[model samples]
Target chain A: MNKIIFYNIFRFIVLVFIQVVLLKNISLYNLNMPLLYILFIFLLPFNTPNWLLFFLSFTIGLTVDIFSDTLGLNAAACTIMAFLRVFYISITVQSERLETEVTPNLSTMGFRWFFFYTLLITFLHHFFLFFLEVFDFTAIINILIRATLSTLFTVFLIFTAEFLVYRKKVR
Target chain B: MNNLWRFISKYNALFLFIIFFVTSIILFIRNNDFQRVSTLNTSNQVVGVFYSKVNNVIKYIHLDTVNKELVAENMLLRNQLKASHFNDSVVVNTVTDTINRVQYQYIAAEVINKSVNSRNNYITINRGSKHGIQKGMGVICPTGVVGIVWNVSPDFATIQSVLHQDTKITSSIEGTPYFGPLIWDGENSQIATLTDIPNQINLKKGTKISTSGLSVTFPKGIAVGTVLKAGVKGGGSFLNISVKLATNFYALQYVYVVKNIFATEQQDLENLNKTQGNE
Candidate 1:
């Protein structure tokens, strides 16, 4: 468990630095497509307590908030997504215990369940983030387009990275 | 102490995380004094180097715009020179300070940092206490007011660009002595709104918006912008005006920092008048 935690910590640092420095500049057609480093919150040990999940999620959001320079916006979005993740996992994963140190890959939950789980949570996150940044929904089409594009882009990257990270099927 | 250390170690990551995050937030909130000085110093040392490189590249691309502005200013100078009282020595007092109540004292600067895309934007200039730049001094491009100085170090100052949500200046539509606090809604940088304007005022589109003497930061009659639209909001006695700013913030490369020579004295006078009259 300590080793898993340590590895995740290392990855989090790399992801945040890259997200702020390099990937932030890769805005293609008003679409700043970043597969959030917050995916670690999604990958935390299945047995981690609920309050800890909330607190950790707040921490993650606050860190991103500090770097992004927008106060409270990203924190709110991330905390909500963190709260929703347990439900997302519960509905998709029927297995009694997530025994291995590995992440909940498609091999564990299967392709259908994994896609739904990632899609639902990623959509929830992007929706909150986009609208909060804009602050008003008068231009609904613009918000919808941003939400759709960013969510699709994030979903694509998460799936591709997950596939490469853990290739073996669930036992 | 041992028990506390053990408790901390049990949740060391969480403890550390909360500590860093709260520290940043507090630093962000209480950001105007010595903490602001340190932030400006650190950012200037780091970003100054980065911007020096960017400035080298920018200098080549901006020559045409710079030349055009200089030529226009030259023409303006010539026009002012033809005015009968263009005498050199007394001219500083009689003409430059002719604007009612407010006196203009300029601090020269070169723009080292400018960002227009962000919601809360600021421009950093290469002059500070070493060159008489001070907090609350109004900053202006050759065309019009860009922002007000919010932070200053010995060698640099960061302006709270008029584009920021925090910007509030006294502005009036030309021809009316009446004025109100003009501010940006933190949405688009190009447009700002004038609040507290009486609904009965006969203002039209294209009415030039200029600084009112109500602020010591800027002199009276300096160009602010032109009104683009006007309307009375829901059951309010004040008119809402959309003003198109005169300065092109995206292209601001150089500016003059205007200091109020009698800011403190005038502030005291204003306070005295209010306090004495109120009682």
Candidate 2:
């Protein structure tokens, strides 16, 4: 338990640092920015309390907002994403599987499950974030294009990170 | 009461989600006002320091390009020197030497953080109120206009980039009396739209666009962009003039925050005129 706590703290700092310092600069044609920090929320233990999960997601989002000068935008999107994560996990993962795996990742959950999870979450987050940032129906098409492109880009980066850390037969 | 408590406990996650979501939305709305949530932004000390430190390392990689831009700007300044020009008319002594009083002051700053991908883009500079950087000051790079100062902290300031949706720059075309407000379409950082110029005027491609000095923010005759296209859209009387912006936002590393020394005096006189007209 202590090890998990320490690991999460470390992950939080490293992911936020990489996000503000590194990923923030890597936009493709001023359209796609890979938000890899969301992966930190995805890697949290299954049994983590719901309130704690929401709080952590909010904190991380707000931290990104603070760095980027978009105070509430990321926090709102991240909170919605957290709610969806809880709903999705409850319907899909069985209680027995949660006890054994502890956390969901490409290694524990396999590529298929992880891919779908990352896709849905990333798409929803990007869609909400971009729309909120624009706040105009006239540019709906532009927002849609940006959101879709960024979602795909973020998911690709997440998968690459997962593959890098994947150990053979860790289970 | 017991049943209500039981219900609340069962759906605590939903309640928590609602609370957080609403709070975030409130913050988002409140954040639109620059002065309200000043500390919550990148201009705050901690985030400012961190970005500047990171930028210090990253700036080294762009040293080659930065040096070239600086050298080019130096050449332009050198060519404008009094020694570079020859006297065409007989020299005459005039007693009114006070006519050249300074109207604007510029503070040099390094761009620590910037984003062009977002619809409402912002730039964080390493100078702030401590360096006489104030809100509403105009920011410009060597190439062209950059943005307006939106918020200022002790050591950092956040600029609302010209790429933002709300950015409106009063600009005019060279060799033409027509002028209009220049705005970003929130699609391309390289392009902006100059609106309200009448369709009657025959605008050619590559006509230079410049600041008109109508506002207190920017000085007159500063290069903004060149006309890429001009035409009437949707039966509107005003011509839709697309401008290719002069500044390269992606490669931007340094900027100057312009302070109009006579801004308050100009604004006060305008306000006084309004009161007199009302009477």
Each model's lDDT comes to 0.71, 0.90
- Where in model 1 is the C-alpha error above 4 Å? A1-171, B1-44, B47-66, B82-102, B114-119, B274-279
Enumerate the candidates' DockQ scores in order.
0.10, 0.85
lDDT of 2 by residue, A16-89 (tens): 99998889888877778789899989999998888999999999999999988888999999999999899889
Q: Which consecutive 10 residues in model 1 chain B have the weakest lDDT in total?
A: B34-43
Give the poorly placed runs of model 2, Cα more than 4 Å off: A99-101, B34-37, B87-96
Error (Å) of candidate 1 at residue B110 is: 3.7
lDDT of 1 by residue, A19-62 (tens): 54445434445444564666767667766665676677766666
- In CAPRI terms, where does candidate 1 land? incorrect
In order, what fnat does every candidate score?
A: 0.00, 0.85
Model 2 lDDT on a 0 to 1 scale: 0.90
True contacts kept of 2: 0.85
